[model samples]
Target: MIETMGDQLPAADIESFLPLRRCSILSYGVGHMLNDITSACWFTYLLLFLTDIGLTPRDASIVMLSGQVADGFMTVFAGELIDRFGRFKLWHAGGSVLVAISFSSVFGGCLLCQILGINSAALRTIGYSIFAAIFNVGWAATQVSHMAMVNCMTLNDTSRVALASCRNAFTMVANLTLYGIALAVFSINDAKTSVDIEDQYRWIAYVSILIGCCFVGIFLFGTKEPRLKQQHCENNQRVSWAYWFSKLLYYQVALVYMLTRLVTNVSQALLAFYVINDLEMAQSSKALIPALIYICSFAVSIILQEIKWNGWRLKAFYTTGAILWIFSGVGIFLLPSKIHNFMYLLSITTGVANALMTVTGISMESMLVGKDLNGCAFVYGSLSFLDKVSCGLALYLLESYQSSPSSEGCHDITSCQSVTRYGSGLIPAACALVGAVVTYTMNLHDTTPKSLSEPLLA
Candidate 1:
């Protein structure tokens, strides 16, 4: 290919073609900062906020499930539409607008109640649920479009991985920023009434939205839609969904991506409750511990950009992360409140595991998509459909049982600390283990006839 390029191109043409720049990398990296910030708020604080604001665990789970269900369906629709119509930036911008509004509504208290003068728990739950679903709809659009951009961004495998790593690094920044904001809010609030307490969350939501929107504007300005799409992106140029269904690699990537999401989302949702209720830690630990985790994740993500990636390295790093989570889970399950301080160490370990698994898992998806822009959005959207739904169901089941009268005779090995322990510990470990095993079996790069047996990976 290099020799062919040399033969075809004049010396002047070659030099004129410049490589991607540091500024370009920064622009691409922060493209999803809004999604990252809002998502961090969603997974880390949604349940805790709902329960604190007076909803039952079951009700809180319902709101969460509604959002997940809406998100799951929207991913397919959005992916199909983007593939057929091909306005990546239009979808991204429109979705960002929806997210900014609906996410604010989700945390700003029940719009219906505020208007109707009704404060009933059921009504508030329903109101929050509506906004949650709407927020997730927009979220699906943004996530699918941004992830699919990896293929169109560049052909170099290393460059592709760099984009993903930079994205992950921004995600860590977003999470940390959220925790810092939450810590400041929690630290300053001295509310005695339910109204004041609710206002604190409202303030947090508003501030987060403001910060996220500013970065989103930067992303919109700096990034350009792929020029190739304008010519090739026609509705008739379709790859049948069956094209993906027949590939074993499709299933492998889908499963690992789904399970990896489960590990991250479920554990994150439970982290606050685990620290506050299970360990009886300080109120600030809810924010502080997660901040610590993201700090470590941010550092690791920056480092991953420097490494040369490949199939074996991907699997090895992912497996190592999984093994670390296994150890973290065991530590969580066995450590007593007597040694709650040790939870900080476990948090650090979990952060490292998160960065490793998440970056590699997403890079694997990019590898699978490769140059196949025909249904690339469908690939990401379908996988995310699985991810959102599975995560929703898992959290709903766990939250529903967290405060059960019997809890089905479940023992905490010390004290019955509800389902927080299991959700934050056991479930993620098992999911990681399964994802790791599946990663081992994946044929990362295959060379064969493109018509009948084109391998997905590079």
Candidate 2:
């Protein structure tokens, strides 16, 4: 085991990063950061847009839920196609083009509705649903290809962690910066005229398309694949779906990675609802806090991995994130409705936990996946899909209580608020706690030095 470890580790720790055979690695990360920013911008703004476009509670829910369905199906195919074809750049470019097209289509549809005076809720619902599905599908495909390429960038554990952390940090910055920009522009315009809401949104869509184009171009021109021989055998050389699926599922570390992501994403969804409804923060404020939290968390995670908690990095991530999450949940529950300051404090703590988990999860995944398999995208996409599903479930549970016909009177508001609070805070904390427990219980760190054979999938 020790020898295997030695073999994998570069002679110098600095040399562990991908040797620059091509500029693709750097470009891949850059593309991801750009795409992430664009996506976050849309996520932040889209909900409000639906409300603006006359979508009722039911219509908005239908649109998001339907997108989740499409997300699940697309991920399976995206993973398979990337793995079999190995055309990462092509997939990426195509995905970007689709994103531009989808967003434009949505904007056009909304504009058409305004022009024809056909602002019926049903029409808006259909238009939004179609837009949501296509947007997510394109995003998912690009994500798959991008991840596959990232997996090939380097073979070092620490380097991979560093790279993922850097990308995540940039993404967080993008999230925060774009929201700030949106808030500044939207607020100024919002005070001028109510009718210009669609105009403001159309401008946002134009920015989204530009970002998508940047990602597509960055990746298409920047990345170059290095020469690596494919593994071949006498008769079983061709890759099989069963082989990939089994390898992904049965690999010990991959199992751990998958479980952690599910927990992390569930937590993310729950928190989103909590911020908007429970704390009663404005959407822009909620978005800003999360961005800060992510950035701070990302920085702390890198330090923990590299220094203070270096040896037990994963443990630190799990334990710190879990404890903070638990406390954050308690804070949310006990926090007064008007205690916006305390709520943000609690958010900061939750952000730290989330940041740690994000970095650790990426590191663990890079460690688990095969050099040739390109499973990072699959794992990422699958994990991404699961998080969305968990978010949907959390939303369902929260909305069920909020919109329930039975609850009435002043007490009902409290009950509904309680649902929103717990829906965001407790659910994620519980998920993280469970993940920490399961991961720790595995005794993954206790493997005998001699027990390290070549990794099953690696």
Candidate 3:
């Protein structure tokens, strides 16, 4: 009887919880570094790699969209399973293994064609699409598991925010690492032919895999599965998806999260194109400009760690980011190739804006889940579902028109009407304006978004 009573005691002992140590936060934060780095490569370079290797712009976009669609489909299912079974570590490990292997295949080129000794464009597209889809499946699993762990980590709101900031900082680190790798790969090897370009991307992919896997190992070794009290979670598994869908806040969050993702991802997808084909800058600018963005983003993420966060503060920071993107987007559209150096300034602001939106945007998931704990994975999955589909469709549509003539009758990047420039500038700016308006409409507070508890860590 006493043992049973003691077991029950833990369920009631809420206030006794202390903050998560910085080491724990840091360890957990680095777990997703693998996902972040791979995702950065996918968005920033996949189109360029595909186009450079002889795939049409339409075909390249199709490959990217296929991965996004696969990822979107996987997130909700992954979330459902994680919420039901509760082995976050297992899911994370399995997903990491998938990401490492399949991601390499996506960038490594058409193994199917190489084996069969055929050079069909359709065959290559299909081969790349298969690997891209597989990679995203693993990516979805890793992402959902890692993110859902935040709710189980602690009960303190401040610590939750700190954890998020730490995670964002690591994201910057991952981007910097990716660009650093690319710069070296591109610099040391001049690609005089299509085959050479493909080889450079393959090498970059291999190096990124090596670096990302080490961080995943650190995460698995340093962090233990949180002792989520069985009593609290026992009933949570049964929480219906409909319960989440019934709330108005769910829709608001879904829309805003989707918009945020579109803004970030779409901008990234178009950047390599803008810098190379449009701006006609040196090959090195491709890596250097993105490096500058992540450096500034990393600094801002560190400073965000020191803030005392709340609901309104989260919204404010997010809106500030959106507005910044608006200005950057417009600047990107208007800047002619003659002033290409000005892009460095825009990269700085873009990085800061990215950090602000990304950190707060992710935190809102925790807020929406509150103390519900039940099917929290589903909540994340559903949000990601929307994000993935929206981004995929947006990228597909924009890239489809890359070869179409501009209405203004301009022939080159200097005309400021190329699809690359238009997609890079106007798309994100439009999304940000809409996201800001939606953010203001949200009704949020410190307690579990709906009721009572620390707003952040638990």
TM-scores of all candidate predictions against the true structure: 0.91, 0.78, 0.93
Q: What is the lDDT of residue 44 in candidate 2?
A: 50
lDDT of 3 by residue, 394-425 (tens): 89998888884334433345577778887888
Which residue runs of candidate 2 sit more than 4 Å off their true CA positions? 1-26, 104-118, 191-195, 226-277, 280-284, 301-312, 372-381, 403-416, 442-458
**Residue-wise lDDT of candidate 2 within 1-458, one digit each (tens)?**
44555675544322223233223334555666545755665545554455555565456666766665676667668876666556677777777777777775554445445656897777777767787788778877877676656555554444455556656665665666666666666676662342476677666677656765675576577666522212211222444545546753334444445445544444444445556655566766655666666667656744543421122566666667777777876666656546666766776787777677667666555554534343445665665566555555555455445442222312233544466456556666666677666556433231112323332113
Query: Residue by residue across 1-458, what tens digits does model 1's lDDT show?
Result: 33444575554333212234567678888978888999999999899888877889999999999999999999999999988877788888888889998998888768999889998998998999999999999999999988887766654556667788899999999999998999899889965666676787788878888898888888889988865455444423677799889989899999999999999999999999888777778999999999999999899999988776667888899999999988987777666676789999999999999999999999889778765677888999999999999999999999888773342332346574568888999889999999999999998862111222111122
Ranking by lDDT: 3, 1, 2
When 2 and 3 are scored with lDDT, the better candidate is 3
Give the poorly placed runs of model 3, Cα more than 4 Å off.
Answer: 1-11, 15-17, 229-231, 235-237, 404-414, 448-458
Q: Report RMSD for candidate 2.
A: 5.7
Strongest candidate by lDDT: 3
Worst 10 residues of 2 by lDDT: 226-235
Against the reference, the lDDT scores of all candidates come to 0.83, 0.57, 0.85
Clashing pairs in 1: none
User: Residue 159 lDDT in model 2?
Assistant: 44
Top model by TM-score, which number? 3
Candidate 3 TM-score to native: 0.93
How does residue 192 of candidate 1 score in lDDT? 67
